[model samples]
Target: MLFDRRAPYDFFSVYHVPDVVTQRQFEAGIAASGWYDYFEQVNISGAALSPVGALLNNVALLPPTPQGPQIPPVSPITKQRVNVLGRTMTYADEGAGVPVVFVHGDVMSSFLWRNVIPHLDGQRTRSLAGDSDKLPDAGPGTYAFATHARYFDAWMEALDLRDGVVLVGHDGGANVTFDWAMRHEDQVRGLAFSEAITPPFDWEDWPAQMRPQFQYLRTAEGERDVLENNFFVNAAPQSITRMLTPAEFTEIVRPYAQPGEDRRPTTDWPREVPFDNDRSQTRTALEAQAAWLADTSIPRLHLPGVPGGIARLGGRKRRLISTWPSLIEAPVPGLHWTPEDAPHAMGSALAEWLRSLIN
Candidate 1:
């Protein structure tokens, strides 16, 4: 996995040096630190380790500018707004032929698929993103899977989308898409997912390095950290292969840059993670969907990223592909955010996979 759970190696030796320390002196101190020694012992020499090594070097040297290519701007496309099930939804509806529906996960909107959508060529595609309606006001039933599946199903139904509609989902959207497919498989033509979460796994199963992050988010302190610092917008960019351009960074962070109910989605998304199993609606719904994906005969595509993609932290046995005989695994290069990191590669893979399904 190119971006596995990074060890919490404290590279704080440079910080301890006097404020007047020269760059060369700082480098000398860092090189002699135990943290640097530990990383030096690890064999980080390959395409898989390049990004990791770069990140480490960046931390050690504190470069004034990024040393890698910057993420390109999202493709140009006009966004349209429409009311779906009483909520105003933003989307891009274009092209013609088979319908391709793109569903985005938390901390992001449909803009996530901007680059990939244009590369889809002749196919008609619509990305339903931006502010979503609050999960139905139905008591404690406001869980992610059931709530999102209900809203998504209604949105598709409103659009009159039925048989032969291609479905593509990312991150949390994967869970929502899987749930929708389980209940409405007959309507879907093909399903493609990347960075999806499937279980028999939970917070405990997360890598030691990442477990703390997940666990902290379950607390009020974590919510404050996210809101005050715009954690998703700031931290997520690091997962990409290139640095985000100033404009691109601004666009991605715009949705959550403010301190209001607008940031609620980012805060709520993590807490709702089905890290613990209970008869809760989220858990029950995810459990059912996980089983369905394993056994479903529907045409499916699994776009795993370089080094492991979403399945990185989780081992092979715990991955959805372990039991999904019908899924076609196409390994592409990128971290969790494949669209930003490897848009061309992702687009080609998606277009090729869809064509194969038709053939």
Candidate 2:
């Protein structure tokens, strides 16, 4: 069997080489071609000789199958646009059945969910991920949580999605989702969060190593970094465990390549983060969402990661899991950008939780 160590596979494929001579020739050819390190050969006989069945009996000798849902390659999603609050918003509307809207946080667009949305059961669920009005590609708008939440409401209205909608948010998007859910509880069916920044926590709760960067982002120097040098776009790699490929990095920073006032959303978002029990509007909205999250009976899912960025710290994650009565926790392997680092596991957990809400 030919196996690519990097590919995601739920099962092993067994190829029947008719004879030992051919097998030796194949091995020799692979070794001669200098690709021997990438290929492995396993021999099976007797009861395992069901070549037609395409099943291996001696599984112990084979490489372990990947756990969790197998993630597919990122594909091009047809971009759809709609006018929401006088701004043209870009979104990806795919699949059918129950509606699940995905909201991205700062420095990212709906493209963040490109790999994730594919894992959902398309026939049973409709996946919708949109770039918020504040995003560079989505046109300009106010960057406050309340304003973003209002824009979300208008986006929903423009799309004619009023009921039975599952709202999933990451980072700042979580705050907006929470705000929208609080005001229109009747319209939302469930909620899911990853690296969410709701339920305002103390500044000390942030990762000690990352505190300096976050603090800097809230300063004048940071504003220059964001507007002139595309700091947030370049710093995205720090939030995730894996290094993004050149292609991926290029695609992510393409919208914010030029230096100008247009990068205001990136700068404004960092400043909006509350610290030391501040009385800012962002803090107020977060605190109110925290209260609603504690009291609401709406089904919720928390897709936290190990050593996650921001809100996924040990105490914060524990509080979220313990305090929220109706929340389900599905921990994945990643840092801050769980969606980027563990899309298969994150998507599978989210799909399962979403299915439960519908059933």
Candidate 3:
């Protein structure tokens, strides 16, 4: 997105940006500028947005109309597609040198890294694989995209993430980052996790969980609706249980009605991606993590003290923070249970941690 020349000021969404481009920044600096208006800015989550979609109008793309005035100059950040994990992955990259793979968590594509991606001081690059879409649904029972971001090696082929990398993860993504270090300890220079959770459940201390979640196959006739409804309810953020307004309760969430190809929900995922492999193979793979953490000696960070996340759906456990602390001697910075409560602080801590690497 480029902001050629200038115009009026605007802050239209909950996404807070302090980059002061409010036509005032341009005018007050060297010349006087015009007034403000109520033109609503557009927004769409990146994973759901097409590169050509209308919402590409991030501040970088807002243009100066022929009749209207222009402001300060800005340019579109050129994008690159690298063959990491076999697929031609689209990503944003800048800087150079020892790389850091800031893997995004499930439900969110790469958009969650937006704040930290732009703040690195030097010699660093970030890349993301647009692998969020489910594998072509060949049949009812066969599902892919099952939070497979958990695998580090296979995914690297699809993304040109920094080689010999620093790995970072948040929430469910923490397992991916730490697990990556375990598998590729030599390739990894350092590891950082925020709001991380590793296996070993402590349900005894859990707040009231409504009930066990269950799923039915697409072949099951009437049960499909029941399966879909409970699926999303389990994946919902705490806000759904707390602050979500009635309208939000409906419009924001209620759409998991057996999603079709077009009208699908990905902003917040519904559950652990349906496991694609046989139950035996998948369980063996997941259960190997604790053993791996017990062995990982790569420099690490464990960030806990964040809001609780959806703990379980069916029988699989959510990331349990207490299960893996041996990996970190000094805990990463943040308050317990509400770290993401302040993104600026999280972003800063992440930036500083990465810089601390090879410094």
Candidate 4:
């Protein structure tokens, strides 16, 4: 009486009848059969109907049950660090083909490009985002562009990344890249900048609204405010349209969270606003970079973010963009953190642009 004799697919045909009628014994007997093994292999997802045990077909080949979306797990990233020019620099090297180097701005490190580098496939792209907070102090009044440029140049040399390498710089790092492009124009194949600062524009010329903010950052009180409050680290995650997850925020802010005055780079950066054309290293470095931007024949890309925000290039940037006929300006959607805020758009555009150059 336990068998449904009239059923089309008889369950008893696939399973052996056991003398013991206990459900556990029945299951064990069915499990030993090849048909039962085949059914077990077929994954049934979603809610299975009771009584008749009906399952809606999802994957047609297998007798389907209700199921949720299958999302693949993401691979973990591995960070690489090296002693370049006596300072420890961190970067991520991935993919293959053309060599592209990514440089990050102050208050941020290579982690900024986490969402972008993967898109630059078919090329060996290394995102170099060193934490200057941990670097040895280069004495008081030392300008970041001059000091960091040396470190960056040394890093390139250490890696034997000499000539024909594409350089992409973001925010303050653009200044460093520009300085290098000017000094060693022959070494670089092309240049790309996003939310960058191009000189000839001084703190005095800074937008009326932002001048006070910069002025405050020049003070000792500002240094305390920045460190105690985690200004750079906290600001970036919040400023973007898409707020970063807690884990992403933790990784980005890790370097700046370290104790001691070595973290002076955070405050030193705001103080080094290239304004005067006098003997100031800041002025000299920026002016030279400006000159390079004006004259270099190298292919260039500029991704201008929304104006008026923390890192978006404003009027000065637009004016500079106008003069460089060879520089290709690509519009990106975002304020300061284009890589994080607009990864898909930025990455795909960048990849297409780079491919065009290669072909």
Q: Best by TM-score, which number? A: 2
Per-model TM against the reference: 0.75, 0.78, 0.55, 0.72
Error of 2 at 23 (Å): 18
Give the clash total for candidate 2: 0
**Which lDDT tens digits does candidate 4 get at residues 182-224?**
7787888788888677654655446454566567777777767
Residue-wise C-alpha lDDT for candidate 3, range 1-359, written one tens digit per residue: 97465434365343322234543354354333223343433332111112322232342353421211121122123456655434455555656776766665533445445444555645364434233333443233232223354435555644545357877676556666665666667787777665444344333322243223222322243234434444433344332212222433343333333454312233222233223433443244445765676555666665443223333212233244334444442332222222222334455566666666766
TM-score of 3: 0.55
Write the residue-wise lDDT of candidate 2 on 1-359 in tens digits. 99765545444556555445665676578679876466564433211122211222123243432433323334478888898877889899898888889999888888789878887865388899987544445222357666777788899889988888889999899878888888889988999998878554677777665677779987788878888899877877766654455666677776677786667777677778888867887787788888888999998999887556675546664566557878888887566788877777788888788768887
At residue 152, candidate 1 shows an lDDT of 83
**Backbone steric clashes in candidate 1, count:** 2
lDDT of 3: 0.43
Candidate 4 ranges with C-alpha deviation above 4 Å: 1-75, 123-133, 137-143, 200-210, 276-279, 308-314
Question: lDDT rank, highest first?
Answer: 2, 1, 4, 3
- Candidate 1: C-alpha RMSD after superposition: 10.6
**In candidate 4, residue 109 scores what lDDT?**
75
Better of 1 and 3 by TM-score: 1
Give candidate 2 misplaced runs (Cα > 4 Å).
Answer: 1-74, 133-141
Compare candidates 2 and 4 on TM-score and give the better one.
2
Tell me the spans in candidate 3 whose CA falls farther than 4 Å from its real position: 1-79, 83-88, 123-131, 138-152, 158-163, 202-237, 240-258, 261-280, 307-340
